[model samples]
Target chain A: MKGTFRASMAWLHTGLGLVTGWVLFAIALSGSLSVFREGISVWMRPELPTVPVQTVDATAHAVAWLTDHAAKSSAWYLAVPNHRAPYVFGTWERPDGSYIQKALNPLTGSPDGIRDTLGGEFFYRFHFELQLPYPYGRLIAAIAALALVVGLISGLIIHRRIFADFFTFRPNKGQRSWLDAHNLLGVLAFPFHLMISFTGAVTLVTMLLPWGPQAVYKQDVMAGYTDLDPALESRAASGKPGHLTAITPLLQNAEERFRGAGISQVYIYNPSDAASLVTVIAGNNGTVSTLSHSLTFDGTTGRLIREHVETRPAVRTYTFLYGLHIARFTPDVTRWLYFISGLMLTAVIGSGMRLWTVKRLRLPHHLGHVLTDRLNVGVLGGTSLAFASYFLANRLLPPMSPHRAGHEVQCVFIVWGLALVFALIRPARRAWPEMLAACALACFAIAAVSSPWTNPVTQSTALVSLLFSGAFGYAAFRALNGKAKQT
Target chain B: MESAGTLRRPLATAGKSLSLKRWDLACRILAALPGGYALAAFSGICLAVWLPGLRVERAMTGMLTGLLIWPVAFMASFAVPDGRKMLGGTVIALLALMGLAALRGWRP
Candidate 1:
């Protein structure tokens, strides 16, 4: 019975991994890129330079600017300057329910006339949304995450030699080498993979299983979300007009109360109204809990309204899971660690696909086997090329081009589609090297085309580009030199 | 090697039941989807009721628990190797949870 159970798990792992491997790879790779989303945003906007400034004063200046220009706005969100993002960002909702976001110059407290590109937000959104309309795209991504959980669990259960094969990396053995690398990557970061997949699925749990909340809240799920994160709590705008009080004192009070924990976001609800209130939420840099310690102050009188520090175990567990998944509390070194782990996860899926094809290739004239082999190339190679093309397109496209961000995303899909076509026409052996070489060239070019030494963010971007270029080059070389043996 | 032949033999026998295999695949797929989802929700709610929390916490925890367990339920539907048994086990669990909830008036 034990042996049979292992066999059943092996079969389950193979089927589940193959069926959803492509989508999982795409999600993981994009998420890996998004680890440096803020840096990428800074790099994309070359005009923004890093500078040292007090976050409290920056928020005060941004709020001052908003007071003059958006006195009647319903609400205002102030993102204080930090290391990754060196500019004060503000977004406000108009009376008509539209929002305008702008980067305020630290010196001038005015909007930075940078290019209207999606910047890092594109990859961050595409990581889960896949650029499809809300709810449906999220739904599909959630289902794929579930598949990943099953794949991880079943793979763990079925593998017989866990410790023995921990350090195995036998190159040039083709399929055996791929399986070794796959197992090595999976086993090394098994905890990370399991945590990321499970929490990721839990992130969308309310949407996936609304019945629990519906039963409790009687169909008002928004209230559930608000309860989970009280920073989302809001009050309607009172029509009574009033003078706006200075927000600097309120922000200073929040900073004092939180004991120098950086303020990530400050929201002014019903600004310039009698009922207005300001809420300052703690930044993720201080702790591994996404639920920020918050302080709400009356907007009219600058009086402290409410203060909260999460103590509930359930909320703490949920937020810890969220924080672990997002990794927002980590420094640059730890962020890179996450990026590496994410890359290994993607490689695990890719190598599993390769193993599937290699095992099936021992047979002859099986359409399923051939198709899987081609798709293996198309997905693994095509997605890498698409990502490289996204960076290349971002650099090459005109800054003022209308729909510039959409076009950049379109370039990704277009090149990826072309790779698919190439995979169909060319032999799998030829397609691997060709697509990989193209990706290597593109990555190298992205690094080469950048200026020598502008800032740390740009320097880091260039370094990452070079690293990817070298990795792709090595993969291409291996594919070109290795004999295509069916063993 | 004859080992490859031996590995292929079971699949060859599976191919002999082409129509029956198709039916079995369809049944398992159904069981994995709806059957598994129901089982997850029922069991999740049952677990949530035992947890110490308020209404929102319990609801969120139950939803999270359901989401985490749904994948396990899905794989179990295929792992058991018998679609009927998988379906029957899920239904029985669901009914049992329902009985508990109905008898106890399950509320957060």
Candidate 2:
């Protein structure tokens, strides 16, 4: 019975892991890249000048602009710029559901017209959304995450001696070497892998299982959310228009209230109306939880209206898990740790997929075996190549072209689609190295075009690109030399 | 050891028969998809109704725990070995949780 149980788990791990391996690889790799989304975004748009310091009252400037330009808006949001970000982002909702957003210069308060590219948002969204339509994309990502959790648990159960092979690595043994590397990466990052998947599922729980709130709140999710996180609220715009007060005072008041906590965002509800409200959300830089302490004030008079700090045990647990998954509260050093750990998990997934093909390559002529091998290269190598092309497109595309951002995304898919076609036509052994070589070239192209020596943001982008290029270049060299097949 | 090997050998041999393989695949799918999902949902509702906390908090806790429950249920779908046992165990656990949930909600 014990043998049978372990066998069943082993089968479950292999079967389900193979079925969803490609999507999991893509998700992990993209998520790893999105750790530096801000830096990547800054690199993509070089026209924006570097923000000197955090001296400007961006909240006041953004509010002043909205008072002049978007006075009729029912709701206004101001995203204060940090060290990495150069511009204050503003968004206002019309009477209808549509929203208008702009990037404003933190110093001058004028709109920054760098480019229309989606920038890093494309990779961030693709990490969880996969660019699919609406709820389906998110639902698929959640399901994939759930499958990963199942696979990991089953794997732990099957591998009886967890530490027996901890220090084992045998090169030139082909499938054995791949298996050893897979196990090594998996065991090394097991805790992170489990935590990431579990928290990822919990983060999407509201959407994945809407019934939980529906049954408890009698289908009134808004009421439930008010208790869960009450920082956000909307008020109708009064038809009677009025002048606004200076927002610097409100921001200063919020900082005082939170004991000098940095203000991350400012909100104006029904701005320029008699019944308007101003809300300032506390930053989570030093905090362990993702939920920001919020203070709402009367927009007209600048008097404190309401304050919410989530202290409930259940909500705190949720926020902690959310913070761990997103790592928004981590400092720069810890954030890089998270990024490297995320990349390690990506390597684990990729190596496991490779092991699948290497094991089946025993029967070389089998179509299923060939298909898996080609797919290993096509999906893994193709995605890496596509991401590099995305950066390349950002550099090459004309800045003023309409739908410039859309074309950048299209470039990613076009390159990826071509690689997939090439994978199908070429031998698996040949396809792997070829795609990897292309990935290496694209990485170099992005690094060269960005000219990373100028600014800190560009420097970070160049460093990451060069690192990937070196890794891919070495891997391509090994694959070309026929040494990639050894265990 | 011989008996255990014998028990496993027949399952491997059964795969050679397409019809048996198809039936086994169907059973596995049934146990994994609907069976596991129902168990998670019922257990969640049971905890949500009976657990000590505010209504939303209890629901959130129950739902998060329920998400964890799904992987166990999924693994059990295969761990049970026998297709009949897998389906039967899943239905029983799901129905039991549902009954507990109903009784908890009956106070109205």
Candidate 3:
């Protein structure tokens, strides 16, 4: 009975992992890159000056720019300059229901000379959205995350010698080697895998399992959200034009109220109306919880209207789990650890998928095995190549090109689709080494094109790309050597 | 004649058992996925309506609890080999939870 139970779990783990592994791999790899989302954004836009600017000064500059250019806009959202992202990022809603995003110069507050691109936001959004239309991508990602949680737990139950096999690796043994690598990666980062996958699902729980909230709130879903993350009540525009009060004093007031917590974001609603409101949100640099501590003031009079802070245990727990998954409050070392762990998780999924095909490849070759093998190479190797192409596109695309950001994202999918086609046409033995070599070349090209000496962010990004190039290059060499031996 | 009849009877039984096993496997898979998810959702609704807390807090706790319950429910669906018993038990629990939620004024 015990033996049968373990075998059943093994079956469950294999089937679940194989079915959901591709989407999980893509999500995990993008998520790993998104660890340095701001840094990548800064690196992609080399035109932006990286001079450190004070938050207050940056806020003032952003508000001044918005007041001049977007006075007729209904609302303006601004993110003050920080160490990681050294520019004032602003988005305003136009009366036509469209939105414009621009990075403002911290010093001059001008939206001049900055290239248009999603920057790091592409990876961050792709991590959850998979580039699919609204709600669908999020739904798919949430379900995949839950499937990962189930896979990890079942895997833990099936592996009998988990500790004994921790140090095991047998190279050049085909299926054995793949299994060993999968187990090693899975075991070494087991806790991180569990935490990340579980928390990832939790982050989207309200979406995936909305029945509870829906039942309670009936039709007022927005009320449920307002309760979970309390925000200041929005006021209607009076339609009469009023003088907008200065933002510096309002920021100072919020800072004092926060007791030294930095203000990260500010939102001005109805900036040109008599009933305007300015809300200041405290940064998460000091806390692991992503819950915002905000103060709203009258935009015209600059009088404090309300302060929103959450002390509820359930909400705090939810925010903490969400915060942990996003890693927004992580310091430098912790952030690196998150990145490395994310990569390890990706490797686990990649290797496990490879193991599935490896175990069956020795049997009579079937179409199922053939398709899985090709897709393993296509997705595992192709995604890395696609990500590199995204970076390459950032540099190669003309800065003034229309829809430049959209084109950069298009390069990623186009290259990825081409890689998949290439994988399908080529033999598995040859495809593995070739795709890996291409990925290595792309990484090397990214490193070569990027100027490493400009700033720490660029320097580190270049170094990381070079390191990835070396790693992929070595894997390609091993794969080629194995192919030669087989022949 | 008797020997031929015995041989044919065993072959027929073997074929029937094979089909039975396939049906059982399909039922279990269905139970694990959809049935387990339903159980989790019903449990969440129960908690949301019954838990003594603020509306938001109860709702959030309910959602988190449901997420935590899903994997366990998935495993439980497979732990028992008898597919009919496993699925039927899940359905019964879901119904009970739904009843409890309804009693607490949960509309959906």
Which candidate leads the pack in DockQ?
Answer: 1
lDDT of every predicted structure (CA atoms) = 0.77, 0.77, 0.85
| Residue range B1-108, candidate 1, lDDT tens digits | 443322322221110112226666667777788887876777666655555668767876777778867887887776676777677777788889877655646653
Q: How high is the DockQ of candidate 1?
A: 0.31
> Which has the higher TM-score value, candidate number 1 or candidate number 2?
2
lDDT of 1 by residue, A1-487 (tens): 6655666667678777878999899999988888888887777777664578678777878888888889888888887878787777778887688877666766656664565555676778888888788898798788888889999988888665567557666677676677778888999989988988888887777667776666666657678767776655667777888766787777777778778567888888887898898888888867888765987777888877678788777677777888888787899899998899999999998888888887678767498878878887888999999888888787788976776767888999999999888897787888888888888899898887667657787788888889989999998888887745534
Q: Which stretches of candidate 2 lie over 4 Å from their true place?
A: A93-102, A483-487, B1-25, B106-108
Instruction: Find the candidate with the highest TM-score and give its number.
Output: 3
Query: Each prediction's Cα RMSD?
Result: 4.1, 4.5, 6.8
Tens digit of lDDT per residue, candidate 2, span A69-92? 778888888778777666776778
Give the C-alpha lDDT of model 3.
0.85
Error of 3 at A272 (Å): 1.8
Docking class of 2: acceptable
Looking at model 2 chain A, which ten-residue stretch has the lowest summed lDDT? A50-59
Candidate 2, B1-108: lDDT as tens digits: 343222332222111112225566678679888888777777667777788888868888778877878888888777776777778777878778777877866221
- As a whole number from 0 to 100, the lDDT of residue B2 in candidate 2 is 43
Question: What residue runs in model 3 are displaced by over 4 Å at the alpha carbon?
Answer: A484-487, B1-20
- The alpha-carbon deviation from the true structure for residue B49 of candidate 1, after best TM-score superposition, in angstroms, is 5.7
